[model samples]
Target: MTTLTYKADHHWRFSPILWGALVVAAVAVYLIFQDGVHLMVRWWQRDEYSHGYLIPLIALYLIWQRSDVLSRIRFDGSWVGPAIITLGLVVGLVGELATIYTVVQYAFLIVLYGAALSLVGPTAFRIIAIPMLILFFMIPLPGFLYNNLSSQLQLISSEIGVAVIRLFGISVYLEGNVIDLGGYRLQVVEACSGLRYLFPLMTLGFIVAYFYRAPLWKRLVIFVSTAPITVLMNSFRIGVIGVTVEYFGEEAAEGFLHDFEGWVVFMACFGVLFVEMWLLLRITGDKRPLSEVFAIDSPQKAQENEDTSARHLPTPFLSSVALLIVAVFGAASLAERQEIIPEREEFVTLPKELGGWRGRVEIMEQIYLDTLKLTDYRIINYTTDTEFVNFYSAYYDSQRKGASIHSPKTCLPGDGWRFNEIETHAVDGVTMGGKPLIVNRVLMTKGDRRQLVYYWFQGRSRIITNEYAAKWFIFWDALFNNRTDGALVRLVTPIREGADAAVADERLQEFTKELSKVLPEYIPG
Candidate 1:
């Protein structure tokens, strides 16, 4: 028996050409990590939370996959490595200066590719690059995509929640984002609209894909599951909140549970994911693990085959210095976006789908959008330098159905106090279970005068559920806080600002366009 002893006689051959890749990779990580904060900040400006827990996880996963290759490759004292490092660093600096996340993203990718090419060679680089790039999905979507998704989820949530509640023998109705139960009414606020879960779902999807090494079929199944999971769980959540009022009284579901219960729904979603994995495994008994099927484990064999096949090129890497210049300019551009936004109006050009809702709005007001999905609306004028928030108090009293009976608060900016105003008007709106979208607007007053308005421009699909509370929780804050202080635009209006009152609508329109995303309805149709 030839005793295959461990190699004491073999020398680790380090390629100076390739060893340079590590420096390039390091510089890449630094640039990405730093810009990551700014990019995330932009997301936050658009009301999206940025989480960083997944980056290290993805990095580790990649490194682990390449451990076999790394074990044999050597680090020779090579100027080539330093040169690559310097090039990557220069690119990173350029990207940073440009403030362009895309440039940053591109720079990061180039560094990754360059490093992988130098260190691991062609076959290994090809095998690793795609999975590594897929990791980009872990980052939160930009504001535009998030807003679009929120609308879709809002429409879907409203329809589903209304259906579920009605089936449970509850007399429920919906309009736009609002839901009406026997003694309970809710407007599916931002938290209930599914934004919170959407990002996590995206992250979860990526993780599931990575860990399962799933085939397209398996991955698709996993991806598809997020929809029903979000919808049904949200429905159940809504039902729970509705029933909680019946059993524990309305106030019981009002505070923390109303806001934090979304985490519970999210956890419940995980159970569904796990079960799906189990089912997939059970279904594929005796078949290949997805990783094996996708040749995830075949890097060594792949490298050997490709080398023998001679189907790859070994061209020397060109200087990425030129690309680095482009990245720098791009970074500078991103920095420009960091500047403060200008003031604007609140009334968005409601799309035709939501246009009919302009007339259909019966009562528009801001609510916590928590346990109770609906509330009366109100409009508060802050410009009055009165002793007792007079403009808002009277505004609240007048629009009894439209205004929420709450103190001054804010959701936007300036020294604002948020207030709710409900306005009722009849108009066409998409409806399920006999609930129609209503029209209305509420203003958050700042320093007792200027206002950031909250208008439910279209109320065609108010669906309510507790599971989606996370998405709408932030919305509740905006309502209760009255588009609260921090960063925002403000316009002072008279105490009786309303549609028929001939209020100057331009400023408010500017606010919404500049501050908030597109109206939750208005799906481009």
Candidate 2:
């Protein structure tokens, strides 16, 4: 016993006590940065934070097991300590510059803990580094990735929500990703999607795994099941609400089911957690040397020695690590702020005149001269006008026209919609932002309800485009030039002065026939 005690007293390893303090400090930082967690939380959160708090306590509790090695730990100052500290400081500064606040701050703690491990000698270095590298999971993903996740969540939740409704024996019809529940429609809004629970639940699961000193297989089971469990339970909750509404009444669903139900569902999740814990314990056979779990820590010394005490590392090693740290911090900082280059406009030439119709297509004085022999002429320049002062070309109009087809013309509230029809009386062209557009007055309708449609078409430069035009750019050429130069005919059809899709289609067909006389090749029969 005395010989073993002597060896324990002389051995050096990364002290659990140091690990505990570092964990406490990290928890403190997170609590302090609560206002900014939205930016900081990328990879891991709930897992890391709770672990931070628990590890210290566990280390203290487990101190007895480590007593053999305790006396061997001695204060040894090394150049690596200052180097790590310096590297951490640099990481924080660069993170601040790029706004990757979480990673930069976390880097300091990682280096501090890692360097302290170094003091335990190379063996301790490898042992500690092996587990500590899991810190990478804590970093937040880039914004683009988050968006994709969000979209996926939206789709999955929306679809599953409808299925849940049907499973409740409620007559539900799903069309084009929309769920129709009797007269009311529930569009799984982004907030209602399961993604909100994903990050949080995964975090909770990881922390729970670390809390139980379960074997690797046990931890894997808990971790992998996190998201599926959360999403499935949430779907059940939504399904219950739909059942209540269909059978009991809307008041049952909206008044009680919709509003104050989150708490109840959350409680349900916790219940499932208890069951999960019980199962895990049974499956893994709780060999709970509690202190080893890092949750119930053994009492630790108030302060511990640094790992890098008196060690010399190659400059190249330091350089490579620094570069990697800088890269991670940089990525975290630029997550949401990538610069997008604006699209350049395309241009084309057109004839000065058409046969029989003088000045049908204008040739401006600021002209790049070109001539063609045809009975009719049209200008296909991208600009709305040839006038250098105002600069007009039908090409810009044509481009914007097709592109706007992709977006909903109706504003979120529908107040922006207007309708108009062709009339002999000329109305003044309206300029929006800095660009001018032709304003036509037409009648409008919504869902079989009739109303007038007063709409405006901007020629695509210096103009505030409508919700539709701003969204799509595919139509610029079709409206500006004769896409299918028809058998040389010219005619016009004034559509109904309204916002009805039915009316718009009829008008479009008639209007196409008018222009088809000039260019009939592109239009489908």
Best by TM-score: 1
lDDT of 2 at 57: 43
lDDT of 2 by residue, 363-431 (tens): 533221111112222332111131111112222222111111111122211222233333221223322
- Residues 1-525 of candidate 1 have per-residue lDDT tens digits of 011211222223435543454355355355444565455445443222443455546656766676555433332122243355456555654544433343345455556556445444444445466556654654454322444555556656767767766666767666555676667776566667766665576567656765666667787788777767767777667666665655676787575346745567778887788777767876888365534533444223223322221111123332343333444455555544432212322233322121111211122333443311222222233221221111111111111111221212212211224354434322233332244433234554433343333333222123222212312432343333222111111223444333332243443333333222443322111
**Residue 226 CA error for candidate 2 (Å)?**
0.5
Candidate 2 ranges with C-alpha deviation above 4 Å: 1-139, 175-178, 256-267, 280-525
Give the Cα-based TM-score of candidate 2 against the true structure.
Answer: 0.45
TM-score of each: 0.51, 0.45
| CA displacement after TM-score superposition, residue 9 of candidate 2 (Å) | 4.8
